[model samples]
Target: MPQSKPQESPARKLLNILLLVVGTVTFLGFSFGPLFQALGPSESPEASLVTEQLRAQADGYRAVLEREPDNPIALRGLIDTQLQLNEPQGAIEPLKKLVELEPENRQLRAFLAQIQQDTGDLEGALEQLQILHEKDPKDSQVLQELADVQLALGRPSQAIELLENYLKEVPEDNDVRLRLAFIYVRNNQTEKAVALYDEMIAADPSDFAPVLGKAIALSSATDENLRAKAPELFEQAARLAPPKLREQIRQEAELSAQRNQPQAVESQETAP
Candidate 1:
């Protein structure tokens, strides 16, 4: 009889089957991947090309601005391009021109205020914010922005006062409460911060922002008793937090507990 063909081992058979399956999957993916990618919900190549062309035009407009520094047309072109490009700093110069050309243009002033804030000039931004706030005292956006700049400029007390006054008028504004909580934390008024956060959470359990804030404030407390309270806050935060934030809250809770431990005492001499 002819010699029997060598039998494939089970492992070899499994490996062959795996390779065949992988080859089939790869072939199918190669055939359909391009079609799916082309018709996906993302922007089309033609749309991207158009965007690039528009960006190039914006760049050209900026070039014209550089050559004719004070040309109104160039100023307008630069302003439009900079706004489109999301370059607030670049928009500032043209906005200043627009303001100079039309001193009464409140809209330009508003845009300048926003650009100033974006550029980290909190004081300058505050001046603009003050102007806006004066123009419309009930404008919550202006009040909020002003209070934020005040806090960033190391004037938490001022922010607290502003928020307090605003909250008096807009008693039901949860946003004001949130800002007040942050200011309280910055001011090292932990109890007030925790209370504000608690009130906010009572209003809306789904508001994880305040929960996280409370956890952070609790974790930062220098008192051991207070720090001990942080674990519960962290647990709450972890429950509502995203995966990355949950891990961070857990780490912070651990670190806070470690920091709360009392230092060991050294033995004293029996006789002096």
Candidate 2:
């Protein structure tokens, strides 16, 4: 008998929404590439009316919540109002109540985690994401967020291990693989970073990410031979890059060539 696939969790569904609302930006050192656009708060009240109107809305929601503590609508309204008022701390208790109202709701849990992250409560965020990861190890969005929290906590080795283990199960996930390579470069494992980029390039020669990633990895290498090859690869990557990115990669290539030129001249002048 064929088994049915599980429905997407609310937590995963809100990755784009809640992560943005909290302003959690993920950056890979050299940026293999942007995976998604910057998503954030929905249309907000104008600056002039923000304080007066939003604060009144927040108070209304609070009054309702005081009468009916488990009211999801009031809880959500309060959260939205507080967030719009730029008072994330004020949103926390209401968010906690919402999570308690539906302990099985992954979306609420994920939202709480993001709010915690935004509030600089990284350990709290990590604890929430850890539970999500344990419940769904193959949830790529959860895995990525978990790894991001690990990175935010200054645990690159742990982030690398988390991504690496997930990659073993889903080897074709280029996004995760690129993230892993970025970590390797950041951790000073340039050889490993270069190797991973080579693998990605071999898989798709026309893709500019690994090409640019390899160029970046090589450009930072201690090996002169490796560094010497960076400018040429950068140029190759520029040719393969999208029209929007082409100019930036071209400028990078030019800068790399200029930087290497003085070293090349020094080597030539000193040679017998």
Candidate 3:
């Protein structure tokens, strides 16, 4: 027997139909062009903040792009949304375009650099940061970002040179000092790291960056005496630290103490 025609539900019909109320409109000789084409919601935070209405809004923004391709507002919104959606690679072209459009806007360039950094395009990020640093050599933010990129690329010496110059100009910047000190430790200048931390501690004994940085530097010390100093410093940091970070400081102290203990090595014997 032939089966009866199946009834289509409204929801099924809706899914089968074109959604987002599409229409055609003529503008500047482009006839029957789509005014807007609604997109599906993306997982990007920039998009997610107003996700319930974002899809249609994004389409509208793109529609704006159709009319004025270089509209800074639309371009910025589109790239920001693209970034929020975690589409860093997709964001690059528009970001570059925007940077070209607003060559002097350092923040936009910084945003583009950040997108590059986030997408693992560290080289691109480094280039942008360098441009920014050259534009404003005294910009600590740019210096730190460039140093970070250098560190990520395993160019510790370059990072050291960059950060040290900035530190010389701004000796009161303990956070930068701590960062430089750690770089020093990584480059096998534990003594220099310790001295910088001592200076930081002298300025503000309660501040945690130097306290933690010094603890780490000392814990990795090959000299037994320096290694022994880590636990006491860690204890002091833990006591002065905020309650939220107190446990973390204590755990670090324990690890430092263990590193200070002498390790037993087993030597292999072979027939000569």
Candidate 4:
């Protein structure tokens, strides 16, 4: 008998694909960049014709689904047709049905969650994300996305807890760590935020992100001693920054100095 090739797991396949295509991380570690290139709607003269054809196809899929509600083929066709038509709302129903039918399919669940997020059904997205997280808590992409959804829903504490737990298991994920620090800054937990940046700097003093993050965090502090450190940190960050960002960091340093001057004089006059 001939040997059959082993099928690759979806998660492993996703990793292989991302490894081949992943690009630069954003300054704030906001994203790991695109997973796939988006194919925007066509603007050519045949655009109307394309739209008409898609609508007809969608109607056909809907008719088939009406007769055979459990037909995965019709469900998938309708989902694709709705997405290409730029009507994500229309895709949600069929996608949900498909997801229910294939509860064990990770890719399908992730796709459905993304569609829910895009269509502003954040609660729905959160539900799906929570399920994914429970299944694989250490998935960096899922962790970041789940945290993002929590923040969007005005639940910073929940986001913080999620990141903190994930970090305990995967402390080396600097991107998620950076994102957690950014969240602390936004939540006005300045000291905690700066501590995270300090840890990152201890790990890699040459890295610009923690340097810049610490500078900004301290610069906003009300304590004179804390606020006083911002200018020098900002200066260091500017030096560490690339040429394109150097001027902007330098400008921040100058502003920090100006803001701290009044407090500096007050502390000087009050000295023993």
Alpha carbon deviation, residue 219, candidate 1 (Å)? 1.4
lDDT of 2 by residue, 50-73 (tens): 577778988898899889989889
**Candidate 3 vs. true structure, TM-score:** 0.72
In order, what lDDT does every prediction score?
0.63, 0.70, 0.67, 0.74
Cα lDDT of model 4 by residue, 1-272, tens digit: 00122444433332222211111122221232322222357878688788888899999999999999999999988887787787878988998898899898877777777777777898998899899989998788788878878987889999999999999988898878877887787688988988998999999999777888788778877788898887788788778866666776676667667765774434346668
Tell me the TM-score of each prediction against the true structure. Answer: 0.61, 0.75, 0.72, 0.73
In candidate 3, which residue pairs clash? 44-84, 44-85
lDDT of 3 by residue, 82-121 (tens): 5444445666877788899988988778777766776678
Instruction: Please give the TM-score that candidate 1 achieves against the real structure.
Output: 0.61
Q: Count backbone clashes in candidate 2.
A: 0
Which residue runs does candidate 1 get wrong by more than 4 Å?
A: 1-73, 80-90, 100-108, 241-272
Q: What is the lDDT of residue 73 in candidate 1?
A: 77
Ranking by lDDT: 4, 2, 3, 1
Clashing pairs in 1: none
Per model, how many backbone clashes are there? 0, 0, 2, 0
Tens-place lDDT digits, model 1, residues 1-272? 01122444433322222222112212111100111011112377876775576578768877886787677777777666555544557777777776677666655665676667666666777787788788888876567667767766778788799889988898888656766776676677989988887888898897556776676677676676777777787688778766555675576567666765788999998995
